[model samples]
Target: MSFVDRLRELRLDAGVFRRATDRGANESAPSAFIRPRPIESRSSKEQSVGRRQSSNEFSGRRFFSSAAGSPVSRPAVSSPKKVYPTANNSSWTTEAKEPAGERQVIKVGTGVRPDDPPSSLCPKPRSPKLKVGITLMTRKPHRFDWWLRYHRNLGICHVFVHVEDTPELLPLLDSDEFAGFVTVTTGDDNSLDTHNPNSPDNYYTLMQRQEEQVRRSVVSARRMGIQWLFHIDDDELLHLTEPFSRLVRELGSDVTCITFVNIEATPKSLNAECVFEEIDTFSQHLMLAYRNGKSAGRVSVADWHGPHRFTGRYCVVPVERACILHFESCTYEQWRNKFIKHKEMGEAKKNDIPFPFYRDSVTLFQEDPSGGKNEQRWKAFYQERKIEHFEQLHEDEKIRIRLTSCPKQMIDGASGSFCKWRNA
Candidate 1:
């Protein structure tokens, strides 16, 4: 507490400070505690370095140059950025398919992308010059537009339509919608009796009418340079494992006629709706329909003799992969409406040579023209067509094929033809 004692303590403190100042910031110390720094002339003083190694040396490793003692920064090596590929991305999908908009490229640190699957999986469409046409005689068809669009998507360049009685379809087929695609004919050609096309006496039956239409259509097909002409009813569709063009191109040059086995459709109910969408499960063997199958003859050399038979320099080849999707009595309304209209084909008179379905249907129409009294019998016919169970498939209904898509789907859209559920 005395003034003399305080003065002695102050002098001792001043001496300790002077000794620490002598060492200065330039001195290397074990502890990172505060040190004294002195101002110097600009000539000798390192501008940034000043008289210190680093003001905050503890933040990181501070390496200083031997000459000027300035700090040098050598950043730590960084690991690569993690790239977790998302589902449904270019990580694994077709190269032909790109993102909706302009694509972006992100080059990761020294990372390499693996080669993708070849584009050959989605082959390009065939040349349109190699034309294939369909010769059909449809009368008031259900989903006739769908049939046209389906075959068009299947690479049928042209369609020769014989309007048995559907005059409305004539203009519709000749419209811009089907201008160059369809060749329409009404009344009768020079090939048949023009006077009485509807008469029971002349080409009135289903077989005769169909053959006559096909025969005349073949000449048109040949003249128009249509290589192959197929005769398929509006009730039936051409089903293929691959593209039809590919199959036709694969056929031997010498082969004139191509026959495909028929797969009959088994309706689930009398509720007639969209046939292709509603009907997915088809029976390999024909139960209530013909099993002989349908044929497509090359128009250049072959003549359309019958529905299935072709004449002139014939070399027939069977492709097991393709078949006809026959919607024979697919629905109650379809069955009733189709056959009921052609009562003449039934008991009204001999349809000349009606198919088994027509024969059976027209017989009912013949028995009961109105189908009023035989309603239960008609119901029985529809019920019999239903497949009760896969466990107990009939001998004719052995192999059951569940199509991946609807039979009336584009080749590219088959995988995405879950339209039933989407529309629902």
Candidate 2:
């Protein structure tokens, strides 16, 4: 990289934007619910940590260790305290409250260099970069590329991308941008109900694949020296108020699991083509599907409760408000494609499952699985829920839409990285 080339890549912009209305004044935060929960520092306590030692496995106060099938634990180091950050209570501006087309956050990184050496005034030695990684499942090139760059710029270190649906895209993972950091898997080792990428797989099979991947990725994360690992989807993004590495520095060694709250992102209009780029506004009033969100746990978790959780036992997960921005059904095409896949795969109707969309698809497709009639049914369902205007969200019959800016903060904060990649 020559001086001229490096200079060309440099940029200058506000780290974050504030609206003229400063909706934060009236709303306080995104919602009345955006208050940070008080977590007592474990540094004050002197309780003895119960180290659960297993054959070739480590647990309790350790980073990541699974039993039976896992590799030997790494040489123990005097690790820093474990503590997750308190959710942000920062003020926010909502789309409904602001003028049309007014954006809340538009941030960019200016390639700020590190401070020269720590002076006596700031005597504390800088801690190691908190190596945080994420487990994601991706297929579409456009979607995966954005996800990789966004999370990478936002502070995610290693990425475990399972290109389950499209093995053809596996070669792309070997590219320069993804080579060293990303670990690509194709569910090749594990014998599942299906192997053909084009073949239809039921919802159960997909869940099995996710759980299998979780099992394998934990061992890999541990080997790679990743202390904290989060499991999220391609359509979803983790919106942290602060850096994830810093979040780990705040948590006590006792806590093992973190439950990230999910807030659904509603498109600004009926057909908001691109969900990630176009859709920013979110409703926190608990609408559509379950609100279980996602989870991030230490690689040392013992058993698999589900993909969202690593341990069946008590792992000290906090009651978070909303940390994950879930972009589900933001576009008519998105909704149409999802149901079509579910229908074609012969997804069984699970009564216990609260995912109404999948269940509805099963019932509807029984009448007509394909053709123009099926398309009409999906269109009707989408129209009933789509937010045509700000007023529609304000007066939603199912649930009131209280616009939030949690995701936009992270998105804009890494704007420079996104722009550079787009140009490159």
Candidate 3:
């Protein structure tokens, strides 16, 4: 007989089946109390046969009775190890026990298997939509409020400002007005020692400090998860033909940075108090190697020559759709202060360099027969020169000027004297 049949015969002989049936009918009686018939009542032959069969079943090879009533050996069954997904759902790991009692680990994530690739577990990275930041190095706290609002409105994610000799603005930096959006870094008093005679005429030390400031801003922006950074001056504003985010996305992955051409914005009349109110027209001549800023993250800037140049391994966008509205000379007073600041910074002595605006301004001041204090003549000269510059523009330059326009709301409300200009 088969092994199952033999086991059934043994149970019947022991009266275990009869006892189990009786216990089931008497539901009140506990199953544990059921007893097998006394083995003494059975013959010795039957008892010896049962012991031999039980010993054979438990031996090294589990046995089963075949069709011919011969014992057959079968392999032992093994329990399967369970696998679980990780929190990110990217991979899975399972632990299995070995025969030697050591634990074996198995990785079975989406991409971990031989047939799977990294793309199976990890999705293709999408281009960042709105991770751009702006960094400005300025000492003019008066324009900070308006400048901050302008960039914030443009959907810039972060702004880093390096304040030079502007301690009073520190309170605004700490205020909740710009809680997480704006960060301010201050330059030491020694930064103003550009006029020291020991320093080179080109003020290499000052330029180095400015470069360091830009590096810090870039680092901070990267920490904040910013994907692109633009380094602009306080007096300049980036003019975008479309949404900045869309512009960045369309640039594609290959382009690491974009350099925008600069066009000087001249005021029609300096009668207005605010520069934004007075300046309505931009120059037609694009500054070829003038002040330029970049718009990409993770790029290493080895050297910062000026607002227009940097040394690094990055591809520049070929189109000139992005341009900087450079308010180089806003008002007579502002220009005078800027000229003096530039002179002290050793910019006036850099004749070998091609900074047209600086060179022209300094030359005008030096050649002035009235010892540079003739305000009316300075204004007239500036206006005449601006007209001449505008007339020299090519057709393409004219198109750039036509495409650029300042948003009135940028300098409106509490951030600026919008009403004051409106009432005037």
Ranking by TM-score: 2, 1, 3
- Candidate 2 lDDT, 66-106, residue by residue in tens: 22211122333343222222212112211211212311111
lDDT-wise, the better of 2 and 3 is: 2
* lDDT sort, best first: 1, 2, 3
Per-residue alpha-carbon lDDT of candidate 3 for residues 1-424, written as tens digits (9 for 90 to 100):
9999999899887798777765465443211101112223213322322111110011122121323222223344463222222223223223323332311221112112232245557554543455667777676533666666666765566887777756888777788878688877666645334333233343345565666666777777667777667777777776654344433443334434555545466555544455654555554233322333333343343334444444442323211234566766566555655454444334335564444555566666666635445577777766665444455543323322332122323211111111111100
Total backbone clashes of candidate 1, pairs 3 or more residues apart or in separate chains: 0
Residue-level lDDT for 52 in candidate 1: 15
10 residues in a row with least lDDT, candidate 3: 50-59
Q: Report the alpha-carbon TM-score of model 1 versus the true structure.
A: 0.57
RMSD of 1: 33.4
* Alpha carbon deviation, residue 94, candidate 3 (Å): 59
How many Å off is the CA of 96 in candidate 3? 69
* lDDT agreement with native, every candidate: 0.54, 0.50, 0.47
Stretches of candidate 3 exceeding 4 Å from the true structure: 1-129, 189-206, 286-306, 309-315, 318-320, 342-350, 363-374, 387-424
The most accurate candidate by TM-score is: 2
